[model samples]
Target: MSAKVMPDAKGRQVWIAAISKKSGYSEELVASVLEKHGIRPKVTAAVPQRLMVTSLSFTGKKLGATPPSDIDFGPKPMGPGLWAVTSQRNFRGKTSILNIIRWCLTGRQYIADVMTSWFTAVTLRFTLDDREFEVRLSNASEGTGELLKHARGNEFQLASFSNHVEFEAAMSDFFMEELGLQKIENHIEKDGKGIDQPHGWVWLFTAMWVEPRPSALFGVQMPGAMSARMMQMYLGFPWVNTTNEIKAAQSRFRVKAAQSHLVSSGIRATTEGRIASLAAQRADLQAKFADVSPNTARLKLAEASQRFVNADADLRAFVAKKQVAEDDFESAKMAYAEARRSSQAAKESAAAGYVFRAIRPVCCPSCDEVITEEAAESHLRDHTCVVCKTPDRKGDDEEDTERTLLLAENEAKEQLDAQTTRVRLITSQINEARLARAKASEQCATAEAEIADMTTVEENTVRIQILDAQIAELRNLNQAETEAEDGDSKVLAAAEVITKEMYEVEQGRVLKRVSDLTKEYAVTFGIENLQSVSIDGGVRMKLIKNGQPTFFSKCTDGEKARLKVAATLAMLKVSEDEGVGRHPGLLLIDSPGDNAMVSVDYENLVSGISTLSEELKTVQIILSAVSGPVILSHVPKARRIEAVGDDYLW
Candidate 1:
């Protein structure tokens, strides 16, 4: 790209300066010199245009005065009156050019020299790289030169080129009459070309022009570079300074972003996984607790604990209130139970006592009278006479009745005594008869037993005598036959028959004695009347009755008494026979004596009893009588129990 220079209406000289280290000045150093001279400069590197002066600096040297070696210095107005003095003085060859351009752009003497110089009437072209670009100077006069020389003689420096330049007549006339610099539009261009297309190149510069003094130019004054540096510091870029605040902010931002991303993603995944896994775990826990729920268990345990606490509180309250004593409830219950049992037992015992009292008969002690249980109880309560303690006349008959009962009791006792006496008498007689029968039976039995073993030869003495008679007859026949050997055999036989007859007669007499003894045994002992007698292997005999016997079987209750008397009598007889007898000897007959002859055959029984007592000679008869005829006829000495009434026997 290339740039072209243009003249302003003020006839101000403008140029381009390639600022580098080789030119012994930087763009920043060039712009600083222009700023110090009160020249506002525009700066550009790739393109040229108006720019603000952000900063400036200078090298402490002067420019050379030789041709071809002179540094390029010019006015480059970036704004209405702001200009930059740019130079391309080769600092490598002549570093002093840096100070020379510094003085020309900013020195007060150089401002006067340009205003008076002959070339001041025309513009100057001060291109550093191209010769084709130039300016024409005009309208210089000797008077202007003398004024400029006088202005330079003073030590006081002008604050700006406009101080002198504004005095130059020609430049002032051109600015006012021909060029009208103040009216010229400030248009930006590129490549020394008009901005007719999007890609035109225009040489951009700034001018600070005044009459009779040199005009100043600045090339591309850049305000953006400084702003960029300020922004770098303000924004705190990490590349410039690691400790920059922006770095801390960036570090904090990155860390927060990473943490947020991790948290968000992790929370999302966890929520999803938890939803599914918790469902499965819930099912598994339910199955595991199928038999029992943990919640239920906890609830039950809590309930139980609560109940226990409640019970403990209740018990404590009860004890405090003295409603219950420690360990006393059990004892109280036991005592209650025992009391109940004892009460029941006492009731039973009382019931049994009532039963016993009902059955038991008691005689009143005061009256000697029997009373029923109820009457006895009343009598005991009243403590009155049991017979007739009442003074009421109604009891007179009761007194008579009691007297009659007393008489009856005395009569009953007398009867009992007489009956006892009679029983003893009958018992003695029966015992004598039983003993006689037993003796005769025993003797018969022995004889029968002895006869049972006898042989016919021992028993038939007649037969033995008959045999001896036969044998004797034969012998007699033989003796007779020997004496009359032939005289008559018949007569000898007759003599043997007579001898046998005499022997048979003697055996018949001995057999008759055995028949008489057997008949005597049967008649005396009554064995002939016995139906049967069973003899045991031990020789004990029992006599059986005949088909029509006189005695009764299994006696009546009344008869048992009589039979008991008979049995007692038999026992007495046996005792007497053994010489160990204790017979009372007094016979007392009671009620049976009145009807003793109901069977006439019973007379034989009575006689037999009397005969036995008489034969023993130790027995006495005492008979009690209610009727005189009965006992008086049987017993000569019979006693009657007397009553207190009119009846003698009563």
Candidate 2:
């Protein structure tokens, strides 16, 4: 890779800043990708203030069949030093005292159930950076408590809670704010799925205590990168916290990408398979059609289809022509009838005029007398009325009227004849059109029947066409789905790898320092023949014991306990020296000698604790053990909370 692509000093920058610097992506786009994958960068906590226990007290009533039916611990005053809560034997309430104090501080009860059943109330007072505060649990079993602060001579309530959940939240918030601690966010695989689990002040306080059980590494027995996160947090490397956040974000992004890819692959595979099936079906239908029909048969079918279409068009034209001819025939008939009626009326009028002219008066209308022959002959010659002796006035008008009527009748007769001829011609044309339409209709029906004989093969052809369209659509969908990841997934995957590499590189320096100090402290705690100790970036400790490589979990119980104590002290000392770590300068150990086979080894552990406590003046060390000369010789009487013989320390 070129230097431009692989930028130097990548570990010091935020994930987005580092990847986007030379990766040709904008910070906004990178941030959007991170958000899409639910990868949020974490903020490192500020340098913490030292925590010291000044005094603590509690009251308990033992359960049935238990020793010490009732017990009360004092308002014990203490300061920063090695304090021992011990007895001549085990189960002496030494661990109980530590548990009470831890419960008060964190609101999480890790005490044994039988022992917790005996507790009714607890009171603990502590300080952060010399700021005095107190926790008073009036109802310990119910987890109700009040956190109070002291100023001048008065006590002010900081928070009040009524239940365990609220109590834990209150204590966590108070301590986190006062001690300058932030939640340690990480990604873990639970039940085969990656999820976010954040550790608060309670988890951070794990550094202050060590139980009798053997621990593989620092903090609780969390799986994956959590113990490493705890180490980075308490060790307080300058930029290692940012690395931790990047690791978590990268893990989340990978899981998200993997899930998305799986789903997309499944969908694409299904779509492609469907498309292939559709294409094959289409091809099979096409091949069957080609195989079943000869070219001559195909040509015959095509010709029949064309003739059917043409005949159907011709039939429609003939029907329209027949309708026009019928309408013409009816119009001609109507014209002929009107002309005949007019001619008849003209004939009747002409006849009436002629009769009226010919029938002149034979006698006087008033007297009914006959006209004389000479008068009648003279009237006829003169064309006059005989009775009135009036000269004939109806001469030219009567002739003219008769001539006009005759002429009108002749013209009307001609018009009637013409109309009758037109009606005959139109009727003939209508018959001809009807015969042509009938012929075309028969031809269309025959052609249609021929075409219908191939219906099965034509149906297959139509289905094949539909399948082609569907296959094309499916192919488009598959292409779109497959291309979706190239935009975001590609960029995010690159960024994830780069961020992980950055974390690995950045953790090296801090881990080396922790490793060196661990080896030194291990030798001081009497780890025999310790050649070298290596703490990797993942916080996996490797030690060369007796010239053989030994991991933390592979070590003996006694050796693991000593190694854990050594690792804690080493981290505390490193934090103190660095002046930037988050440890609260407190250490608590339970039953340090329980696994010790030799008194010398137990003495060495106690001696190491004493030496470190004296040298680190501001640090507090509290441990519980079975009473022995090894513990009594190093820790003074003033710092010892011991049992009377085999009695309980409570």
Candidate 3:
């Protein structure tokens, strides 16, 4: 309604719409997706009323004593306006009482360890709006308690718990429901990254307690944006919780982005390194390939190899022919010898026959008579053998047989001569084939030696092919890595921009109001030569004194005390006046006059608190300090809860 949507459904819708525009997604899809991720705005609605303590009571017992002794502290009555708890000295239980009240209210231990060990039970009674509530603890250390509400002479049980954590959570829930205080969330460091941490009543009570050491401009001194968030929560600024949630999400995104970037960069670097190595190998292979003159080498080797193969084949043929020729020569020699023998035998036979015919001798006849010559001659004329022929018919037959033997021998001699000539020719051809094969072998060897550095062109070509494949794969991987980007960072940035735009003007106005109040209250607390005070949304307070600039930490202890008080009172006053803040209207100041403070400064602080308490009737100011004339004059005797020398405040 006020131009800036309060932290609610509308706020969430606004955030979703803004993110959708940046991310190019539909609003409904964006909302569902973000919801799945647990990314939604926090709601901040201001409560107009405040909580006040009406009474406090507790019991303590001496630990480990021979006889147990119990000491009782009031059912002390406390109401609105300035109430002082004082002692002449330190550690006199003045601060203890305040700590007990805080412990009972938040269910957290703020008292000294000794008190926590000694105290057995505590009870705190407080009021919210027109309703009264009571907290009863059976064991203070364990925080075993029951929360009760009183209405029309009847008591009602609200919650009960048995341990500290449960007690704290119950109390926080009760207060959030009763007082409209929402849970606060902060980003804390875990394992070198920011994580979301939800806080309950313990964190919300930062504005309710003021420590002795003045550190920041507003609410319990904390680190980073926590203090600012505390201030904003108390001041009832619109969208404060949403802003804090967005900032925490941003912190988580930053840590994740950094980690994702490192991982992506490592992948890219490894891929690039592989690509470089493969490229170098490819270049080296290319250079060697060029030097080898592959085309010429391949041609020369092919030619020489073919020539060698052909020549070797021819040599094999020639050797086979020579073997055949040798076999034929041996056969021819044998044939020639047989032919000569045949011729000799035929001639001898012819000569013997002619001699027998010319002599005409007869060895035996039927009667061995002396007329053989005349008979043998007659038989020869008849062509018959002399020894056993009935008639003379052997002459023509013997001549014909001798003539056939002579003719066959002559033919055999001619065939042997031809075979010998053929053998000689084949032997010469074999010699020539051997010479040609040797020449071819020499040429092939020379060609092989020329391209020895390349280890045969085939292996070189394979290496080149492998190098190319690797380079291509690496390049593709590099491209994929480049394309895979972090989308969370962009979403976080968009969220940050949208949240900032939503709350800047409203937060500026709130800070200006607080700064003005701080300057005014600083003067009221008697800060010397103070011209102006400026407080930014960062909770950084700058003081302009005598035309010189300074900050909260730079001031002296006394001045810092004054500044802290001023800031606290300014916030309270602003909340009361605006009717829009969530401060509980309860201020607990512990040792505001410590650290060798100036007496006048202390008096001025007491006097100012008295006047402010009168002006803001709803605020209850509880001051713990050493009893002095200044405290005596300002705080009435009836409201002073004091401990004398060497005594506790109980």
Candidate 4:
């Protein structure tokens, strides 16, 4: 049969062969393993002839471009060699399987040559030194029949080539070298010869095909001669080479197994008890359902029979009781209808009587005139003649006349009693006024006595001392002038005298100033006269103006504003005396005329403010005005804050 190998130059298929050994794996198992390794093979034979084949060219198409697929070229006829392609790419390169086989074999070809033999089936051979082993992978092919006969092949059976090869290699390496089983033996000895003996020997083998089929069974042949003796030594006369300790271990294992079986039995019994209890509870529930109600289980036939019995009994009872009640109800309704008609007729007769009597008006007894009942009652109770002041005696039958006479007598007595009360009130007031006058006289006498004890000597003494000093200074200047020789000296003396007189004159002018201030304060505070200024009472000057006594009563709005400004200045003067506006400075008035209308004598008020500002030279005036036409027309440089809304001073 034609086979397909790797892709050709144009990427087309070429003839190739695919061979796969069973290795105790099913066709599906082999297919799965091949697929996992990126090789998809189709199963061509099963049972006696187990093999899988997948063309290299077909696999190449599946893998896409890149590394080319490797094709098998069959083993060498007489030497150890593997057939494989070296050219693993699509482009020009060397293409041969011998090259790949030579790479793997290396110096091991001498051992591998003895293992290369053609057979009908895929038989993989492995040699360890001189020991040769063969594994029949699958049934032989028709073309391989002659070769199989020479090789002494038998009928196909389940076999594992991977297991036989791995086991042979493991045994050879372990016995001949320390890389395998010998290493394990050395480890056991190194632990100590007397250490607990190993219960069993375990061998692990690694073969090329073993990994893909992990679940497949691996048959290991421990040389028959050796295994046979081992079995005899283990079972027959087992105590000959085994220690007593080993026997004890075997006994202990048996006893533990027995105890485990007993525990399992106990668990099973407990489970059975729980099951029995559950079954009993279920039965009780079923019995309870039966006793719940007999009708609960009734069929439709039984329900219909019960319904028919109930309907017949109810119909008969309804007919027997209904007739008697209907007859009695009819007779009672007729009597009620007749009684109701008679009652309605009597009500109509009473209403007719009321309507006829209401048409006429009643007359008033006192006035002897027609009036409504409501008005008549009012007139009778009041007993007054509305036309004149006379008592209305018409309604006074004996009882009412007597009542009226009694009322008249009572009113006369009330008037007499009121006159007596007035007399008593007048007498009481006269007595109270006399007593108040006597108390006032006593208070006046005490006040006059206290006033007589007062004196002004201490105040006059202080004023005399100030006047004496001024007189002595003038005398000294006059004496100095008298010493001069000529009339020019007299003129200079006259000039000095004039200057001294002016100073005295100014001091005297303050009296006029005080008088004017007192008059203004008296009018503004509505007092009779100025009294002494008291230094002890916050610089308060008492006044009695117009028979009204007041203290520091110059409290008009303008005065109050001036007082507030003065107080502010006094506070500032105490803390700092030498700023921009120091003593002996001129007063500047700007907007003083604007608020002049509010002052009593606007011009005099402005003049007084300017004088005070000059006296307290640190002070200044800034006035603003809105109108220039009327009062305060003389004040110049009066700046006005422009008016905005109605009457607003912004």
Give each prediction's root-mean-square deviation over alpha carbons: 96.3, 21.2, 28.0, 71.6
Name the candidate that leads on TM-score.
3
In model 3, what is the error at residue 208, expressed in angstroms? 1.8
Candidate 2 local lDDT, 1-650, one digit each (tens)? 00112232342245677667645677777767666655544334346567888898888777754465776888788888799988997777888788778888898888876666677788899988778999999988888879999999999999999998999999999877776565767766677577877888888888787866667568778767777777766765444454555566666656765776677677668867876776687666666666455224445645655655665565566566656656665665666566556656765866775566556567777988876788778777886667766665556765676567566656655665665566566556556655655665565566557545543455666776786677677668656655554545565665656654644554576567778888988888888899999988677889998899989988888888888888877777766765657788887888887774478888888998899888777788899988888878999988988896868777
Cα shift from native, residue 503, model 4 (Å) = 30
- In angstroms, the error of model 3 at 612 is 0.4
State residue 397's C-alpha deviation in candidate 3, in Å: 99
lDDT by residue (tens digit), candidate 4, 1-650: 01122223211110011111213333344334333323221111111110111111100111222563332223322111111111112221111121112111111121123222322233333233223333333322111111111123453322222333343343344322221111111112222232223222222121111111121111122321222222212111111112122222333333443454465566556655655665565555555454333332223334444444444444444444334434444544454455445555555655665564333336544777766565545545665433332344433264454455555555555555554555455455545544554554455555445433331333234444564565556556544543322222222233223322322342233323333444443233222243422211012334454456554335443333332223223322321231211111111122322332354444444444444434443333333233323223333222111223242210
Best by lDDT: 3
lDDT of 3: 0.76
Higher TM-score: candidate 3 or 4? 3
Q: Give one digit per residue, the lDDT tens place, for model 1 in 515-599.
A: 2322222222222343533222111223344554322123232332233233223323433333321221222233332333343
Model 2 TM-score, all chains together: 0.64
Residue 623 shift from truth in candidate 4, angstroms: 5.0
TM-score leaderboard ranking:
3, 2, 1, 4
* Candidate 2 weakest lDDT stretch, 10 residues: 1-10
Give lDDT per model, in order. 0.31, 0.72, 0.76, 0.31
TM per model?
A: 0.15, 0.64, 0.64, 0.14
